[model samples]
Target: MDFVSELAVARYEKIGEIVGKCVEKIEKPRTFSDVIDTVVTDKYVGIPIFLSLMWAVFQFGYSISVPFSDAIDVFFAWCAGIASRIENPYLASFLSDGFFGGWGFVLVFLPPIAFVFIALTILEQTGYLPRAAFVVDRAMTRVGLQGKSFIPMLLGFGCNVPAIMATRTIDDEADRKITIMVNPLMSCSARLPVYVLFAGAFFKESAGAVITLMYVLGIILAAVMATLFRKFIFGGSPSPLLMELPPYEVPTIKSALMSSWLRIQIFLKKAATILFIGAVIMWFLATHPWDATNGGELIENSYASMIGHAVEPIISPLGLDWTAGVALVGGFLAKEIVIGTLAMIYGVGEEGVADVITQHFTPASALALMTITLIYVPCLATLGVVRQELGSWKWTGLVLAYELILAYIVALIVYAVASVVML
Candidate 1:
C-alpha cells in the first residue's frame, strides 16, 4: 500500500473506533488468519517472505518430482524398445522414433509440471497469491505497473497463454498492453524442462538455484521492460491498485491435487496434439533418405542437420552449436519441444539426456542457452493470443522483434561474463 492507501485505511479505522464508543460491542480475539496476514504482509518481511516462498516452491517441485519423471522415462523407453524390434525397418523407425519418441520425450517432464501447479495451487487456495500481489504492489507501481499487472505476471509462471488472457482484469488499456508484452518474459512452466535439462546437466547440485535464478531473472526483466514501455509507449502513470484481500483458507489435499491436475490438462492436450505433430516432423527431418543416410545412421546428411547448420552461424557467437540452434527452432513452436528435439536427436529421452547434453555445452554456454530460452520469441500459442488480444499484428511483430533482439543481447552478455568468471 502507498501513503494514500495507508491514510485512507487509518481514517476508516478511526471512524470505526468512534462508532464503537457509542455502541456496545463484543471484542473477539484475533483469528489465525489475522496472525498469518500480519506476518505475511508485514512491511519489512513481506517481500523477503514472498521471495523465500518462491524459491522453496521451485526447489520443492524439482526435488520431489525426479522419481516420478524417471519412472515415466523408463516406461517410455521400454515401449520404444518394443517398437524398435519390429521386422520391417521403416515401420519400426516410424513407430519407435516418430510417435513414441516424440510424445514420450515431452511426457517425461509432466510430473514436474504437475508438481509446480500443485505448489501454486497451495499458495492460491490459501489466498497467499493475493497477499503476494499486495506485498509487491508498491514496488509494482514504482515500476509504472500496478498490483493487477502482477497477477497476470504471476500466472505467466504457469503459462503465457492464460497469463495474457488474465490481463483482461486490468481495466486500463495501456496497462494491459504493457502487461501483455512483458508477460511472455515471465518464464512459463513450458520453459521448466529446458531449465531442468540444462541445470541438471551443468549445474547438478545447484540445479535448484539455477532454476530459481531463471524465475527471478524473468520477473526482473519483466519489470524493467514494463517500465520502458510505460515511459515511451504508454506515457501514463499506472492506475492505483484497488482490490479486496480474501480471507485465507487451508487447501484440502484432494482439492489441491485435483485443481493442479486440471491446470496441467492443457499441457497434456498440447503434448497429444501439437507436440506430437512436432515430434513426428522433427523425426522425419532427422531420419529421412533411408539408404543415403542409412536410416538415421548418418544424421549429418539428414535434412535436420541442414536446418541446424543454417541457423548455427546466428547462434554460434553465444557458444552454441547447430543442434542447439535446431532445438531453439523447435522452441519457437513450443518451449517443451526444445527438450523433445534434443531427445530425438540424441535418441535418448530425459533418462539419458543429461549425459548427451553435457557434451554440447560448457557451464558458460549452458547459462547463455538458458538465458536466451528465457527471453526469446514467445511460443506460437502465446503470439496468437497477443495478436488477438491486442488486435494488432503490427504490435505482435514488434514483440517478436524486440524480444529476439533483447534475448540475443542478454545471452551474449551472460556468455561473455560467465566465460571470464570461469577463467
Candidate 2:
C-alpha cells in the first residue's frame, strides 16, 4: 500500500481502538444511537468555542502590535527628517521618501501580522484546527470541496502562496487545482493593512467589525465560486474528507511564540525586499524627471503612470480611478504593494498613507475598492505555484480570467448598490 493508504489505515485502527475502549468502560451497552450522539450532538460545542477563540486571537494580536507599530512609525519619521537635513537633494529624497518611507509602512505592520500568526500557530499546534475543519466540513461539502481543503484555505488566510503549496496534500488533481485557484480569495494577512487602514481612518467606530466582515465575505465568495467551478468546469464527485483529528494538547508558549516570530520574520523580509523595491520604483516614477516640483503630478508622466493608464479602463467599472488601478496591478505582484503604491501616489510618506486614505476615499469608494481587492487576480507568487502544481499554464490562465471577470462584476454590483443606499 502507498503511504497515504497506510496512514489512513493506521488512523482507522486508532479511532476504532479508542471507540472500543469507551464502549467497554460504560456500565450499559452503547448503541449506534449513542455513538451518533457522542460524535454529532457533542460536537456543537466546538463551533462556538472555536469562534470565540478566534476573536480572542484577533484581540490579542491587535493589542500586542499597536504600540510596536507606533514606535516604528515614529522612528522612521525621525530618520526621514535626518535625511531631509542632508545636503544632496537626490540622496535625501531617496533616503527619506523613496527607501525609508516606502519600507517603513511595511515594517510597522509586522507586529500585528506576527500576533495573528502566533495565535494561528497555537491553534494549529494544539490540534484544534483539524476539529474546526471537521466542524466546517459539511458546509464545505455543500460548496463542492472536501473538508481537508479547509486546512489549505486556512493557510491562505496567512498567505495564498503557501496555501496553494499546501494543496499538495489533496490527492485528486482536479480538486487540488480548484483549491489552488480559489485559495487567493481567502484574504491573506498581507491584505489586512488595506482593510485596516481604510476602515480605521474612515469608519473608526465600525472599522474592526467591517474588517472582520470583509474577511468573512472573502470566505463566502470563495465557497460560492468554488461550487460554481466544480459544477460547471471540473465536474467530479466529492471525495471523502478523511482527516485525522489529533488528540488535543496544551500548546507550548515557547513554540507558539517561535512560530509566530518566524512568520513575522518571513513577512518582514518579503516586505523589505519585494514590497520595498516596488515602493522605491513607484517613488522613482512619482519623483523622477529630475526636476518635477514636489506635489506635482509626476505619476502622470512616469512609467507607473503609463502602466496605470493602460489598465484603468478595464478596472474603471469597479469604481477605481487610475491611481487605484495602479495599486491593483501592483497587488498582483504582492498584495502589500497595493498600499505601498498608494502611499507613493499620494505622497503621504511611508506608513502615513492610512491616515491619508481616510481623508481622500469616500465611504462608498472605500467599500468598492475593498470589494474589488478582495476578489481580484491572484498574486504572482500564487499564480506561479498554481501553474507548477497543476502542470499547465492553461489552467492558470483560466483561473486568472475567471477571477478578473468575477471581481469586476461583483465590484460593479457592490459599488452601485452601496452608492444608491448611501445616497
Give each model a TM-score: 0.93, 0.86
lDDT of each: 0.89, 0.78
Model 1 — which ten-residue stretch has the worst lDDT? Answer: 343-352
Model 1 per-residue lDDT at 168:
99
Which parts of model 1 are misplaced by more than 4 Å? 1-29
RMSD of candidates 1 onward, in order: 4.2, 6.8
| Candidate 2 worst ten-residue window by lDDT | 33-42
Give per-residue CA lDDT, model 1, range 1-423, as digits (tens). 999999999999999999989988779888877889999999999999999999988988899999998888888888888999999988888888887787677888898888889999998999999999988999999888988998899999999999999999999999999999999999999899999889988888999999999889888888899899999998989999888988889999999989998889989998898888888888888787777668876778878888899999999999999989888998888888888787677767556788888888889999999999999998999999999999998889989998999999999998999999987
Name the best candidate (by TM-score).
1
Model number with the top lDDT: 1
